[model samples]
Target: MIKLTLLLLFFIIFIKKNICWSDEPHMIVSAIAYYNLNDKEKRILNKIFLNYKEDRDFNDPITGALWADHIKSNEHSTVNPSDIRRYEILDIFNEWHFVQIPYNPTKMFLPHYYLNAHKGKYNAMGVLKYIYKILIQVQKKPRHGTYFSYNFYLRFFIHIFADIHQPLHTISFYNEHFPNGDKGGSDITLNYHGQIGKLHHLCDNIFYSRKKHWPHINPSILQKEAHVLMNMYPPEHFGSKLTIPSNKIDFIDSIANESHQLAIEHIYSHIPVRLVNKDMQIKVDQHFVINLKGILNKQMVLAGYRLSLYLKDIIANIPEDL
Candidate 1:
């Protein structure tokens, strides 16, 4: 009995740890959006994601299956220095790559991390600053006659964009009181519609679940809500006491609206939402029930539009295609 109990406890701990480390669902959706492209667009996207897959070694059974097709066959073998040169190509997209890392969440709330080398309490930021410099070097290399791989960069761009948009990914709890150990807001607990849950899991997966679907709201409504919230709360409200009071219907409404907009724009629109019945049955007609396909269709249009904007700025300086 004692041995069995120990084994059960270990299993429980293992599950919790694994769940904690799972990739954010929104990132998954973004990756899928890139994967489902076709022709010229698909080729360009493939070149980018191929590099990301190799760098991250995304071969785990669950996540790997989603990205396995894009992993390079020669990635493990010897290759010329120029064969893996997209890191240099990233220079064309440097402005997007640069993100502010949040330290001292009490005073400032930013998300994302970079390598910094400075000493003392601020040393991490210094390391991030130095890393950014190195990244710039990689970006400046010539693309002369060099064929670029599309596999990793595609997924990397998609993943990084989604990661930055996540509020928790942008902020840190670095104060002595909170110790900055919330694992990107996953540590904080809250009653999400009466269910006991942690903020991290809530934002990452639970929020993506179809079982407890949140209502859909338009962007204008969300914009208004965000404006109101920005006016009502101080930045410090995002600190340790991150709670939505019972009386704050407006606040809750605003959050739900904003979350829904983010969902519509960044997530729901990018992939098909499969609906499953209580008996574990799949609903075919309702497969893309979230109305995400239309949303993704729009996002692809937006991505192409945005990509053109960057291409115009960067490609104009490059040799013209014959």
Candidate 2:
């Protein structure tokens, strides 16, 4: 009986270790939209996203202690200052709003269980973290007032909005083998175009390929859909409950396994179909309306809605009218 029980445990661990993961393409589209806006708008958006990125704990210099190191190292370089500033802004946004979850392609594995375990809990912390960042920023530059910079505010607001919408960003995965690590869905691997790739980028960029192509959609319709999907699953099922931090291997393993599964399901379900073409080329029709373009528009709308929500919160805290 003892031997049998040990075998069963080993089997469960084996299965858990080999799960696959992916991110929804629509989310990437939203991110792109937030990132690609003109300079006037990009600066404001940068501030909001930058705030969130700073709040998240990452190895990057901007958010980490090494940020000054990065600056000192690059001070002598002849690179464009504007570009560097832009990159700095984006780096800051990515750390807090985007969790770089581990993922691997070529294994055909999914980490649904890992993501599900952290659905509700880690996400709330992320939200609060972002909110707290905004408050700090406001307090630091109170003299700037809410009217400080519309462009900056808009850009910041939109990016963070999308961040919160990404289910993986909100949850965490814990496991005895890898305790307190939130790789999102990056930890899983999948087969893509005959090569191994990370599941996190696959889901973040490729899942909604159509959106990148189209880039326009009715904002109202998109918001309705995102809201419905986000609210579809209960927070607890997604690991919403707060808990005391610990390093128990088995306990953490269970959470990671569950969170991975949830992230896969939630992202896959909303992946826009237009973005799913095996070939990079899209079929053009006589109607002058590209099939993929239509899909892209829908994604843009969804992104816009989510962006609006995130911005609304940040904007509210500011003392000026945006």
Candidate 3:
């Protein structure tokens, strides 16, 4: 019920802060995920809406995907019982979307013990564990009178599935300038094509320049993109390479591992980070842009496809009691 209220007090804080991708990409991923749902999975999703149809948004996966971000808006912070404290308390939800896996192996890294001590903190990995537990509970016991609780978890899971795939979100590189962490490149500024911005925004703001190029997201387009990416790197690659994890921890951990590796090998790889006009900025060479675009496309496609599969498997495989 508290989560439902928190989510209901929506959109006041989110727009002011940075977002992972513009709504378009998130929508695209949701649409693609919807496309991948089997008929039985689709029916199970509709069942979650039995008591929630009036809420409406959760019934629609694309809009449902953005609900978590919407609730982060600031006005909710003021309206809640704790007033300002509500914002402070709710701020943790933002970090729940991104893991801060350390990138540098050579530097004086924060000990694993230090990090493990912080478990249940707002980092993406920890929050994911919490969220998954809540989801399993909601699935098993459900709320007495409302589907709102179930709806909230479903919506949040939809968004984070997309969020973790954005490599920068899962990575926190530590080095000389950023002795603590780069806060996913927000601390590092970059100059791309004469425009200067934080390195994180360079990745975050990779939006569609022309509508014609990106177009409105729909299942068809998402399906096409998903297939293209899957054909290049089949879903079986991950499933076949390792034992399919049985629990939520191992499941979410696999995705985080992929995200962090991408952060080191692709997002942070060989990019020149130096000062320009007294502010640090990363230099984007032509080849880097080419690769960056490719990686982003692949990540988006992969996120959508996997999110679909995850939801599908969960519903079809759940105990009949659920």
Candidate 4:
């Protein structure tokens, strides 16, 4: 029984890596965004994020970044559970991590690909917009504000904002071979040297430094990496796109689209269509790995910069009394 339990635990950790950006990048993005806030905004967030049900897990900005991901259950999932159940008190869902915009080759990368028809509003793009609206309304009417709800969605917004910036999270591969879509590269296996994993896992863990047991990893190392990424790819690196859209929906959609484009240019362009199946796996060479890391690093920095702006807007609007 003990051996079986330990095996189950290891399996969960292994599979979890394929699902979303590993904890290191998620926390690092939040750390970058956190420092971008002014003194007052920081103070407000520090207080607001102090406790969720008195759980100290989300009290600090960097540590708290993983809250949204943590709430999602390994078994049942919390995002949009059809039936109201005892365990799912939160709206956190495994689905909220990615928006599937199909990358169909026959279609010649048409504009229709960007439409939200795939998963409707259940995806990261739609949910982020929904939560932003709620947070805005809650700030306007602090008298009717639910503190827990506010904190809950705020954490989700922060996490999801960074999520959509990840290329694989915004788009999936769909060709004649995969009529159903690749589930954001999760279905497509890749062999990099001797390491074998899904394409999604490779993209999610491109940072690949001190990944295991990440929750207890040194906080300073995360902070230092965040600073290094920011210095490496400053806001000036991305012109005009960094401008937050006045329309919240447009902002969310725009970032999702940006990540989708990245999926096309960086991810899919490299792999041949013939080798997209389980039988014949995609063989990754050293050059591809190096270039992928560079692109992913840029994505991380971009996520952090854009997230900082979004956080500033959210923090600025919360009612002083709330």
Model 2 bad stretches (over 4 Å): 1-94, 98-154, 174-182, 208-300, 309-322
Q: Write the per-residue lDDT of candidate 3 for residues 290-317, one digit (tens) a residue.
A: 5776777667767877777667654654
Could you say which candidate leads in TM-score? 4
- What alpha-carbon RMSD in Å does predicted model 2 have with respect to the real structure? 16.3
Q: What is candidate 2's local distance difference test score?
A: 0.36
Q: Predictions ranked by lDDT, top down? A: 4, 3, 2, 1
Residue ranges of candidate 4 with Cα displaced over 4 Å: 1-17, 75-92, 107-119, 210-213
| Candidate 2 lDDT tens digits, 202-294 | 434323232221113344454454444444432233342323133222232333334444455544333322232222222222121223223
What is candidate 1's lDDT per residue for 172-260, written digit by digit as tens? 33433334333444444433223344444434333333111111223244334333433444335335323434323223223323333
What TM-score does candidate 1 reach? 0.36
Q: What does candidate 4's lDDT look like per residue over 246-283, in tens digits?
A: 87667788888888998888778887864466555787
TM-score against native, each model: 0.36, 0.37, 0.72, 0.84
- Which prediction has more favorable lDDT, 1 or 3? 3
* lDDT-better candidate, 1 vs 2: 2
TM-score of 3: 0.72
Rank order (by TM-score, best first): 4, 3, 2, 1
Q: Which model, 2 or 3, shows the larger lDDT? A: 3
